[model samples]
Target: MKRSHIPPLLDRKWLAPLLITSSLSLLLFLSFSLINAKFPPPASGFSGGGSSSELPRLPRLAYLITGTKDDGARVKRLLQAVYHPRNYYLIHLDLEAPEGERLELARYVKSEGVVREFGNVMVIGDADLVTAQGPTMIASTLHAIAVLLKRAKDWDWFINLSASDYPLVPQDDLLHIFSYLPRDLNFLEHSGDLGYKEVERARPIIIDPGLYHLKKSGVFYAKERRSLPASFKLFMGSAWVVLTKPFLEFCVWGWDNLPRTLLMYYTNFLSSPEGYFHTVVCNHKDYQNTTINHDLRYSRWDNPPKQHPITLTMEHLDDMVRSGAPFARKFEKDDPVLNRIDKELLMRLDGRFTPGAWCMGSSRAGKDPCLVSGSPIVVKPTLSSRRLEKLIANLLDPETFRGKQCK
Candidate 1:
């Protein structure tokens, strides 16, 4: 092809300037792109090219749901109640449960078409023996966390629950509200008030046989007691937690020795689950400010409380809702209250997943809308979200948030 004609005088001066300007602009753009890629904006605020009112990316929750013998059905029920395509779930039936129970759970997980499609749920084949009040519980939780961190790289928070626990709100409500929150916030009930725990828990030395044994057994206390730690203050609270991914990584990877040190220390501590994460988060300067002293679970303890909270019943239904807690514990297997929750709060029916924005199918004649899946990021929150929002607001308030930290 013949070259197009150009004015010689115009070409000589303008072409060189134009080329230089364009080349300079390209170099500047690439440099800025590299910088942006290397060090993106902080997760707290909006990055470039988005409206200020636009919400942040939705969070993915990693759940560790544990149970014992005869809890396989309950575990499946709990999983259905909280199922969301965006989140990851690891079902762990401890070694106390029979191998058949574990296999049944695995088979059920495999059978669910939606769960199979999403590939977010797993059953632990090699289960851990988790003594309720022992360090083995903590070990099981941490193991689940490690598995989640390895398998699902994008989950934002880790939550531990038992088959006895159930959600008070839909997963959409939780995910929607959490989309507006800072990813670093760790929701753990913590207090340094050693009160009776000093005598009952901290000073006691116990051995968890579950750690070294194939069969489950209670933790036995030594005849002699030990003095409290001078190196770190003891903090204790509810074992149930909603922890940030970064904090869990710190615990699992143990870049700093504090987590490992506390792990070893808590190995012999009674009810270690209640104190291990609390003490670790409180003692670490990086995580202390991130603590939001609440486990986001509602339970009715008896007068002078017992080992476990009272089994939640229909009588506690009104209180459970009003508490604005996302979860409640110690419900009896197949309780009527759970059915009520399914009918009311969750709008879930028998043998169906809780309906959410991601569920695209029709819902006439008591059908599951979640039969057809949609984008997981599409969060259409319900009125239940307002309750969670209120709870979170109160927790984040100056009087409760900072004032209650590590205290």
Candidate 2:
């Protein structure tokens, strides 16, 4: 008697109301999701932090661009090629260059509207005779580094380039890829195997006149030979280098005696620039493992090699692009290849800085985009960054990294 047929509630009337209720709930959920997508929460870091995902802070580079007599114009050109507001540049024209030329370069830096606005570029007033084959080159390089450290406080890496060196990619492209790298890594191409240097360099005792003389001169070989260093192993390679600020500071300040001792040892050594930093970094326990063993520079050598690398030209363009290095060296002044690099790779105007995301000014005809500057942290990387990323990945491979370090 109690089982009266409560009609089954699976009726069309009930179905319509149930579907409408479900649809409203779905719409409300979608609206809420879209609103959060449009305006995400603020990042936990300081103002203008890159992303909330903990992306690494962009690193700044300290550049030492050195030149000799007749290099004034080339140095100026190289400055524009690699100029970035976030980085610091210390340009040196060794004592060999005339005062007029150095003044001209200073005038050029002062006259550039962008350079003046950022105030990141400087020219060394007092110079020394940097003999290419003597220890004086090393002294000049160290002087430039000390100047950079004193003038700028926030740079992370120090790069040494000559007037002959040229950039293979845009500064933005290079900096964007470097942002992901470890700050402690030092890029120096070095080796324990001395090869011909064992007989030619290690055993020789030479005296560099430029070290003591105001006038430019060459190093002379002495009558007696000397023994190889017993304390620290010798390493030598390309004179060009990209080093970390901490490592350079360690070198310049010499809180540790190794840097000073090595400096004294290399004083009489021929071509000390090739071996000073290499030996110092390799011998030290802390910096030995940080060596990347790659200079990240593209250079050409003749068969059996000569004292100097062959000048790069258009013929080397394809190989250079494939090498994925950030810079290439031994380019002749005003070479045709440099023009092509400016036009294609760096997107630089004839007399202007290479344009990047920080350049907020108009790019109208005959006008420079970098004339009006923007935030220094903003970077617009190009496809070349992918190439640099690949190069870094190969360098950092676990199987290969340890094997290449300090060996």
Candidate 3:
């Protein structure tokens, strides 16, 4: 080949291509950073372990803070109350929320100095279909657990919370006590639908569109009803639960295949959330003994019973604290009782981070003092921790603890 014709391109073209490739690589890197900055992980919760001689070493929690249509602010409040550096968080907004709300929630997560620093929180880019009373609720929870497991191997517990729910005790109080608990224990309420089958819920069949559809819609019913499962006993309880990582993994992996089958069978079952965790825990041999028979929430149902549980108000403050439950649910948005709880129970004010032993800043009068974020450890259990300590003690007494297993 002649020098002039020998692809003059090979002579200097190599440098141009190299420069172009380098520039593209740099641009790609910067674009990724900006995308991450804008959409940051949908994280809205935190976790850490506290001491519980009655329970094992305190375990790290992986929280899934999920919300639907217009829940951005509620999720933000939930995340702040529960945030901790020692655990993992995955925030999820259902497909119903507008793009603006999703982006707004993401912006809030990224703007937090602590959230950006820890980098343990994440947002679900593709939100799941979550119906109010469908098996999809269970599916969504399992999906979160699967994602958390895939992302980090350190969390010991998996807690699910809604935008409507709030924590009564600080994470530090909960962590301090949970540290002394067995890692395999599961907390859920159980009534077993025993004599209650005649009631509408146990006998009826319903379908949730959230598992399949995009727009928000109520669960549907089928005329051709089916009988209950003969293979497994049916148990029912509160939708909210505090599940151990082991149990959640079992539900997701289901080496025995029960989890998947129940998921399918419950597709038509009414209020599946009330039964999914209950049935799974009751039937699993390895995990049945770990069931704690309590939902760890202070939910008050009406005297004769109503579709929705009674809402907590300022009047319920004393009952809430005496209940010994660490969390409560179904409060109105920005209720005055929330302020009372923050002032009296959490010592949180001014919409700042809740101060804990990990927060080294000293407070005066009513100022929020979490500005100085110190070592993430060093839990300071308060009188609230003592209340929880006593409550957990009674629950774990050998007579009650062993006797209540899977009953």
Candidate 4:
């Protein structure tokens, strides 16, 4: 309609070429901007053009540290040992803990200088009822996983621990070694053989009071027992595990109905925590091949295995180290071995966090190196990393990794 008002420039032969050039220029600029936004420059210290081998992006771990009545102190201690600026933590004190203790734990988390600065640690405002032998325990773990999935965005792995569990190496060592690993792999000790568990655990129908009652009480066994599930094969292993975000997302989101279905089936199964995840992971084709079949925890059991693992003491230190496990459990409060581990392995002071590259402050005059924060992506692996590397190597060995799955 404006043809009558066309200027001499529009009539020129160069006008068409100029318009095409301008359109292409605008489109190219937008395309470049999107590419830049999608992949920003690496952190300051990192090198290379996107290969993880040249400069791996440090991995972050999300820990669910749970406790009961008299476990606040131990939970706090465990927090200090595993705390890092780059990672996220969720602390849960069960309903058994008094209100004062819960408040104290929340206050402690809020008061810590580094925690306040990074804003990474969280104490659940409401506690979950957890009965270890019943489905409620598994429910609590899933609840924590769901919360972590919603609250945090960058964690690579999710590890569940109790107040009694302690790390054998500093967070830096684990982070450094894990940076090289594939993010999809999951570390858990699982087997398809249910032998004795089939009778003692799977067949027993029990109801956990924690699931419904406000006050915690023992689970009651029902007169009727259910048969083994026909839809899915049962698997059993250690309750402790190191899992992945994608797998846990599958567990929590339930886009595929398998997780929800199995969860309902295990609601009456005794010791559901040991089998729920194991069964779900093994039955799914996408996740089955990703299993590492190692819990990465050190524990000593009696000859025939008792109700619980033996409490660790100084005598088990060498064995714990030699096993190349990253964590161990069932330590009494204020165990001497904890002090030894703090001093020798973690290089941590009594109240300070485990020392790592991020801790740039002075430690020369008994000051906490973690007082000052540095680049979070930098990792300084120590001798402990060598043991972990070996452990990973053996577990991932072609013959070993494939043979240990589902079966």
Error of 4 at 339 (Å): 0.5
Which tens-of-lDDT digit does each residue in 1-407 have in candidate 2?
01111121111111100101111111111011111112112222121236646454779899988999999999989999999887888888888899899889888877777677777887777776788788888877887777666667878899999999999898887777777666778898899898988778778988988878899877899999998989999999889999988788778877677888888888888878779889988998777877888999999999866778999999999889889999998899999999999998898979788888878889988788887887787777887777777787788766887898778
Per-residue lDDT over 123-199 for candidate 4, one digit per residue giving the tens place of the 0 to 100 score: 87677778878888888888878777766876889999999999998887788777667778888999888878888
Please give the lDDT score at residue 161 for candidate 1: 90
Give the best candidate by lDDT.
1
Clash pairs detected, candidate 4 = none
* lDDT (tens digit, per residue) of candidate 3 on 94-127: 7787767777877766677666666667777667
Those runs of model 1 whose alpha carbons end farther than 4 Å from true positions after fitting are 1-53
| lDDT (CA) per prediction | 0.79, 0.78, 0.70, 0.78
Off by over 4 Å in 2: 1-51
TM-score winner between candidates 2 and 3:
2
Instruction: Mark the 10 consecutive residues where model 2 has the least summed lDDT.
Output: 10-19
Measured with C-alpha atoms, the lDDT of residue 302 in candidate 2 is: 90
Cα lDDT of model 1 by residue, 4-89, tens digit? 12110111111100101111111111011111122222232222112345445778898988999999999989999999887888
- lDDT value for candidate 1? 0.79
Error of 4 at 81 (Å): 0.2
**Backbone collisions counted per model:** 1, 0, 19, 0
TM-scores, all models, native as reference = 0.87, 0.87, 0.83, 0.87
Query: Residue 174 of model 2: what lDDT?
Result: 77
Q: Global CA lDDT of candidate 4, please? A: 0.78
